[model samples]
Target: MATTVGVVVFPGTNCEMDAVTAVEGLGGSGRLLWHGDDDLSGVDAVVVPGGFAHGDYLRPGAIARFSPMMGAVARFAADGGPVVGICNGFQVLTEAGLLPGALQKNRGLKFLCQPATLRVETTASALTGRASVGDELSVPINHFEGNYTCDDETLARLRDEDRIVLRYVDNPNGSMDDIAAVCNEGRNVVGLMPHPERACDELLGSADGAILMASLLAAA
Candidate 1:
């Protein structure tokens, strides 16, 4: 059977179509799911694409965290289903408590858009399985609240468990530990500040973003 991937589109979310295109480009069927839908009927995987959900109101992803679709997303991840969140989606995941830490404003306090180099930090995550640890790849990041922050204990625990999946080599946003992406304890849920879907094609720039989506599809 063909894999059916669900990409949740919330109001004000601008990357739904881009993420759908990336998913279809990888030979999977991309299904658009609304934020109010409670059912993830045929989805083998779920994606939360980047955008200013709720117009970045009340914090980057704060309001979107309470959306109806998030309940389903929470259940999906808890059941070991693969879920990937990019940029604003990453913010949503953190707010949803699916991923640890918070994405704060950039240390420079500017909205950035540039190709960033990140080191693949783990092989067990569904998002970074295709890349070996220490391997570096470029992905684009465009956001003001891209800085990752967490308490010392949580940071240490994440490192101890190898839950950190992607680390920015250049640390573009002053994120603690240079962390870019991290997975849950099961390694099935991933959230990162970079817009991987935006980098899926060479026409857009680079294909490095496709690696993570490919890894997610393969996991499905």
Candidate 2:
């Protein structure tokens, strides 16, 4: 059966379709699940896409964490379902306690929109299982609060457990340890600041993201 992937959407979410398009392009079915909905029964995988959820009020992903859909997502994740969060969605994952670390303001308080070179750090997560360690990918990033911050103990645990999935090649944002992505202890859930869905096609500047999305489909 074709993998059915659900793309979760919130009021201010702008990249749900981008995520859906990327998923369907990879031979997976795409379904949009509204933030108000709390059902996630049929989907094989879930993607929380980018954009300003609830206007990024009171901190990005803070408000969206309380959305009813997130409760369902939590349950889904607990059952070992694949879940990948991109950009703002990454923030939501952290706020929901699905992933570790928080995305704070970018260095110099500037909004960044450009191509980023990412190095695959591990393949244990749902997003990077198809990629090899040290492989570099070109993915675009669009965000103001993309800098990732975590406490010392969390960083130590991430390193010791091989949970850090990706790292920035040139360090575009001031993310700690040049981290670009991370997965939970179970490795079923993942969050990244770069928009792999936006990089699905070569015409969009890079097709490297296809491997990541394809990995998610295979995992699902």
Candidate 3:
């Protein structure tokens, strides 16, 4: 059976359709889950795509963390279901406590929109399970607050637990440790600044993200 992937849509979300297209292109079914909805509808996997949630008013994901849908997302993740958060969605995951670390403004206080080369640090998580450690991927990123930050103890634990899933080959936002993506200790929930859905097609620049989505589908 094809996996049913739910793409969460918040008020300001603009990439939900793109995520849905990517999932459907990969032979999976994509469903839109509204932020106000409290049910997951038995989706096999959930994806929080890029876009400013709740206007990014207080902060990137500060407000979206309290949405009703996030409660369902939390429960889904707790059951070990696959969950991948991209760009602003990553911020939401962190704010929701599904993932650790906070995304801060870029070092130079600039918005970045470009292709980034990321090295796969681990394949233990659902997002990167189809890739081998150290494999390089070309993905696109679009965000202002994409710099990842965490305390020393959290950083040490992430390193010790192999939770860091991707690292920028050439750091663009001054993220600590050049980290581009990470996953929860369960390895089921993943959050990344890069937009894998935007890079899933070769015609669009790179097809490397297909590998990541394929892994997510398999895990789902």
Candidate 4:
């Protein structure tokens, strides 16, 4: 059977459908899981797509972290299931303490919505396992607070562990170390500022995201 990927849907999440469609297009089954629902329904993987969760009140992902569904996600991730967060979903992962670092406002304090070039830094994680290190991908990013930051110790550890999965070729958000994506210690959970789902189709400008999504499915 095809892998069943669960797309978490918060109140302000507008990209759940996109994520679901992308999963289905990749030959996986996609299911929408409501933020208020705690059940994962035995999904093989979980994806938290972009959009202002809880309207980004009190900072992005702050309020959304308390949603009932997050608890279940936490448990699912703790069991080493694959979880990928995109854009605002990346913020939520950090807020939920599933991933490290924090996403801040853009350097110019302006929202960014454009294509970005990212270099695959590691394929050890579930999200990028299908890619080779140094492989470049063209993906889209749409967010106002996508600047990633972390403490010196955390940065050192991430580097030492090869947990930094992706980096921007041309820094767009002033993120520390030009980081575009990162994975948890287990390598099962990953968070990134770019929207891979938006780049899954060639007609949408690029199909580079297919490689990443395929890796997730295989890992699941």
Compare candidates 1 and 4 on TM-score and give the better one.
4
lDDT of each: 0.91, 0.95, 0.94, 0.94
**Mind giving the per-residue lDDT tens digits that candidate 4 earns over 1-220?**
9999999999999999989988899999999999999998769999999999999999999998999999999999999999999999999999999999999999887899999999999999989989999999999999889999999999999999999999999999999999999999999999999999988999999999989988989899
TM-scores of the models, in the order given:
0.98, 0.99, 0.99, 0.99
Clashing pairs in 3: none
- Cα lDDT tens digits for candidate 1, 188-216: 99999988888889998899989888888
Provide the global lDDT of candidate 1 against the true structure: 0.91
* Candidate 2 vs 3: which has more lDDT: 2
lDDT over C-alpha atoms for residue 192 of model 4 = 97
Q: What pairs collide in candidate 4?
A: none
In model 2, the Cα lDDT at residue 67 comes to: 96
Off by over 4 Å in 2: none
Question: Residue by residue across 29-86, what tens digits does model 3's lDDT show?
Answer: 9999999998997699999988998999899889998999999999999999999999
Which residue runs of candidate 3 sit more than 4 Å off their true CA positions?
none
Best by lDDT: 2
